[model samples]
Target: MVLNYLFRRKPEYRTRKLLCFSKEQMYEVVADIENYSSFLPFCTQSNIVDQNQSELKVKLEIGFPPIKEKYTSLVTMNKPNLILAKSCDGELFEYLETVWKFTSVPQGDPMTCIVDFSIKFKFKSNLYTHVASVFFGKLVKCLETAFINEAVRRYGRSSTCIFEMTSQD
Candidate 1:
């Protein structure tokens, strides 16, 4: 009982499926840091303070109910393959990291790709952590759906296959 509660407050790992989109297309959607607020959940604003071929400095404002926070992060991208973002400074979080990995489907199986998305974060405030723990699973699902919906909106859906699993799976 105690362990369950403790574990819920720590970093979480999740894997989901994405189908029909090429690796490059999926990469473009995730790497477009400045447009995140338009699709991402609770993201009120996003700005690219600096950007280059390999890295981007971005700030995002997210809010849920009465809580609102802004944080800056440096996102490093490796073309149409991998993207990683880490929080540089944030009052509400101790650490926040998210990774997106895209792998093309085997040839002859249609032009599809598998997107592996994972996020780990810890809040600095115990009160906030407690509040978040109750909704973490749902929050992750919303984020995943947001990305997929955005992809369909932009690239048009060809095939769709989405499944969710935790580290336990």
Candidate 2:
């Protein structure tokens, strides 16, 4: 029991934020996986190996100091509502999944939306897992900011409202 406790999988991290962009705008920002390297932190390279209307197979390489790893993920898109990406092939990860949900703010401006984002992942190496667990929250936050920044660059800032709520287990 003690060993199990010591070696438990890391908990998922989730965050909700109000953005100045519409749901469709945010969806386009996330669904553009091939452009991730341009804005996403630690992402050195991103390429779509295969792509269709509803899904894509993406190869991504991320580097963090002494650790640099490449992985392939299957990304599924549900139009302007949801985007899901799961690691399908990788030597670095035991499992990895990210979910992005976007919805129109109730009775709010049509140009505004709420984004719910979550990530759950485990590394194949114990050392990697430990290192990642320590910096997971901050890394996730940076990723979220990167996306928002990209949106601002593409569509221009619509509002100054930057409300966010985050949770990490």
lDDT of each: 0.81, 0.87
Best by lDDT: 2
Q: Candidate 2: deviation at residue 42, Å?
A: 0.2
Q: For model 1, how does the per-residue alpha-carbon lDDT over 24-68 read when each residue is reduced to its tens digit?
A: 888888887778888999998899999887999998999877878
TM-score of each: 0.87, 0.90
Give the least accurate 10-residue stretch of model 2, judged by summed lDDT: 2-11
How big is the positional error of residue 40 in model 1, measured in Å on the Cα after superposition?
Answer: 1.2
Best by TM-score: 2
Model 2: residue 54 alpha-carbon error in angstroms = 0.6
List where candidate 1 sits over 4 angstroms from the true fold. Answer: 1-8, 108-110, 163-169
Model 1: pairs clashing at backbone N, Cα or C within 3 Å: none
